[model samples]
Target: MALAGVRVVELAGLAPVPFCGMILADFGAKVIRVDRTKVTMAMDTQARGKRSLALNLKTPEGVSVLRKLCVQSDVVLEPYRKGVMEKLGLGPEELLKENPRLIYARLTGYGQSGSYAAAAGHDINYLAMSGLLSMLGRRGEKPYAPLNLVADFAGGGLTCALGVVMALLERSQSGRGQVIDTSMVEGAAYVGSFMWKSRSIGMWNNPRGENMLDSGAPFYDTYQTSDRKYMAVGAIEPQFYSQLLHGLGLDDADLPSQMSFSDWPKLRQVFTDCFATKTQAEWRAVFDGTDACVTPVLSLEEVSSHPHNQQRESFLQDSQGEESPRPAPVLSRTPAQPCQGRDPFIGEHTRAVLEEYGYQPQDIDRMLSTGVLECNAAKARL
Candidate 1:
């Protein structure tokens, strides 16, 4: 229980919200997720390790219950449009007044304030606004979504969680609470800082997949093998590139010139021809444990069973029989464990959670009857 005894509250939604809860729970925090009565399997997996309470925020009782939790929590995570929390009576300002030591983390697609703050957006929109879309895909193809990984997890979830931790540390000294305004767009822009600097200095081009790290450098790209499997090579240094060329037994007279960018097309042609003669496994054998900086591009199904990953126990099966991503960066002591329980169905722990929060059982029942709180859909009827 890394976050043992620390109380956190989560206003649940999509990726960032549930991912944050998972992180906190992994560290041993008592995370209470406020979920709607309806539950989905995706939500269940992400919502693991947290207690759930269903409160129809449309009702005054639901709002009341949330306000009480705010008073008692050390941190609160909300991923909504800027004013949605305020509309539900759980905005940062109001919550800070209730718990001055609380770390209020707000995650949204735009931000707390901006011309686009009120506009609807998603991961793809953020990527486009941050100039990341200009560098994706081949030169002639349209930009594909880099999945939701960039904006949702790295930009949104990780930024919010890190900000909350920083705020918590500051609060220890000042005994005060603060609002962390985390926007997916701004976070994505921060992540592209290196690209911005490179472009400013003329070392980078915005053309899609035509720059050094994209597909420009023959030594730093993916190549297909005879079996149609792919391998990635990152032999960037001169010595490493030489080693790669030497290890592959290419004749020096036939090798492409290394320093001439204009010759990259010709060199790339040579590499393509050389690599196509062998399978991925053959290349792996040639470069294994070498300075050529080469490796096979393994699929997700193959990765977990890879020798290195299996030895490191990078993936673990939980008690629920789900093979979930494991806790990372092994600590010397107080190691984090795989989450054991299924994601609680909405309000599955409503009565127990309210009791722990100091509400009497009868009072809890009254709230349920009056629609201030509800557990499952069946309770909504009576």
Candidate 2:
């Protein structure tokens, strides 16, 4: 719980915003998500670990409510187009003027000042722009979309959260706040640092899946088993690759050597033909405790029920059987744990939060009546 006692107000719509809130909430921040009055609970995992405060930003009173919350918050995370927050009258300038130490983080598809800042885009577009999408998948095939994990979570959500924490730490000394404009595309590029270095040295090629880590090496790729299950291999070093060869009972003299690009196709065929002899489980048993770095590619369902995950309590349960994905890196002390609640229904905590903020009962009633805040009395919808 690195952010204990801190209060974070998340102005969220989708994806990264909710993820940033989740990270903040996991570490004990009082995360209050100001969500659209119309969005539903079932569609958003990012809304987990926070009290909901629904506001109709179409109304000026809604903007004022968020402004007040901004004044009281230590951090504010907004993932919108460049001008959307400014139009809402709760932009960084106004917010920082109210509280100089507040960490204001803005996440977007491109970035704050880029030419395409206001353009519509998604994870795939950002990944494409970073030259990362060009390096995924099998040789001579189209680049595969890596679900939305890269740009949305790794590049956008996680990066924005990291920036907020960094700014928060810096603010402790300066007592002055700043704005962080995080572009998902730029973040994606930052993540592909090795690719950039390779490009500089002319080791990079734009063709899909021809690079070493991108299925170019037979020893560092996925192979299908007899049961149609798959396993990953990572015998990158010569010694490890030798162990892999030995474990598979393949003769070094019979197989093509590593680094012989001209013979890689022939080597891959031999390896693939050999792997087809066994199921993924059989392959796992053979390499179980070896340094060859092989692993069965478990499905999501399998991972949820995995023994190692269960032993470590990696997944956490809510009232629903579904659990939070994975607990983060372990800390020596003050380990993070799961919050009991799921994503709250829209405005589920409006009245309660208003009360906690010292709004008098009469003021709360007036605000509710005046359309300043809204709440759902029913329990959160799954």
Candidate 3:
């Protein structure tokens, strides 16, 4: 495991922080998720590979406990509007004084200091600020957010994790850790760097959705099949486009040049009518394993059983028999491990986690008796 012996204190929030914690846990870090005292069932897939400790941070005792945890932790993930942690006395300035090796990773929408830093926003808002939203979706339609994937997960969570890893590498030589102020807005723009840089060149010449990769090109978009399902096409090269035409039983000689932007609508309609003549499965038979770059638009429930995914174990059944995606970026050796068991109920590991952190039995019992801690069992139907 790459992150073996790393201990992460994840102050639980929504999407981004949990996802960051999950990635560290996947790589063998021991992640303890600090949840609110009152919590419901675990519906989050990102909750995997974590132990939960429900503590009311609004209380002095809970904040003290968290401070102690940070003093002993390798990484502390904070996902809040700016100033919340500082108000709680758990900010990096205080914690890093105690634990010089602490990687205080802050994941936020705006950042530590900015015009919108104190304002509230969600994934869509962050993406919009990043300027990534303006180029998304179809040509004439309003900019459609891609369900929070770009900002929340890819930009915020994934970028924060990468920063934490790089900080760890730097700390090995410096013998000191640093704070990572990861703003989702900046991260989203960085993640979309390719598109941004390409736009200035010839790649993205037209307006939104009128470009080659943005569903503007008839050969690179999705088409509905006879079964009402869809297939995605990305036959950009001359060779692959030839394969796409051949798969559709069309001759290249009769069609417009592959790059004719003016004729794209005509080409799209022709491909649409042709795709509608066959089931998605039939088209899969024609294009699968070929260089056409055509693949069925599989549903959530359908992906686990797909031949390629199954062979690679891209999706695996967890301890509760629920199918979840496996950890990605496979390593030749010491590959990341999937979450082992059913996710913990809120506060399920409160007592156990406290004991692991060197709290005595009496201390644990006192915290449990007070309003400081909560220990629970059984899953809620949240």
Estimate every model's Cα lDDT from 0 to 1. 0.80, 0.82, 0.91
lDDT of 2 by residue, 202-267 (tens): 555536566667788788888899999998989989989988998788989887778787788898
Lowest summed-lDDT stretch of 10 residues in model 1?
36-45
Where does candidate 3 have its weakest 10-residue lDDT segment?
373-382
Candidate 1 C-alpha lDDT tens digits along 1-382: 5567778888878887778777878877888888775454335457768877887887777788889987888988888887888887788888887788888888888899979988888899998888787777765788887799888878888878778778877887899989999998888888888887888776565467666787777888888889999989888888899888986687657765775677878888788877888999899889888999888999977888878889988887766677766876576776766467666777767888888889998999898888777666354335
How does each model score on TM-score? Answer: 0.92, 0.95, 0.97
Q: How far is each candidate from the true structure, as Cα RMSD in Å?
A: 2.8, 1.9, 1.8
> Quick one: ranking by lDDT, best first?
3, 2, 1
Q: What's the best-to-worst order under TM-score?
A: 3, 2, 1
lDDT of 3 by residue, 1-382 (tens): 9999999999888899999999999999999998888667654568888998989898899999999888999999999889999999888999999999999999999999978899999989999999989999898999999999999999999999999999999999999999999999999999999998886789888899999988999998999999999999999999999999999999988998888899999999999999999999999999998999999999999999899999998998887888878888898888998677878788988888988989998998898898799888444334
Better of 1 and 2 by lDDT: 2
How many residue pairs of model 2 clash at the backbone?
Answer: 1
C-alpha positional error of residue 369 in candidate 2 after TM-score superposition, expressed in Å: 2.6
Model 1 residue 310 lDDT score: 94
In candidate 2, the residue pairs with backbone N, CA or C atoms under 3 Å apart (3 or more residues apart, or in different chains) clash, namely: 18-46
Candidate number achieving the greatest lDDT relative to the actual structure: 3
Name the better of 2 and 3 by TM-score: 3
User: In lDDT terms, how accurate is model 2?
Assistant: 0.82
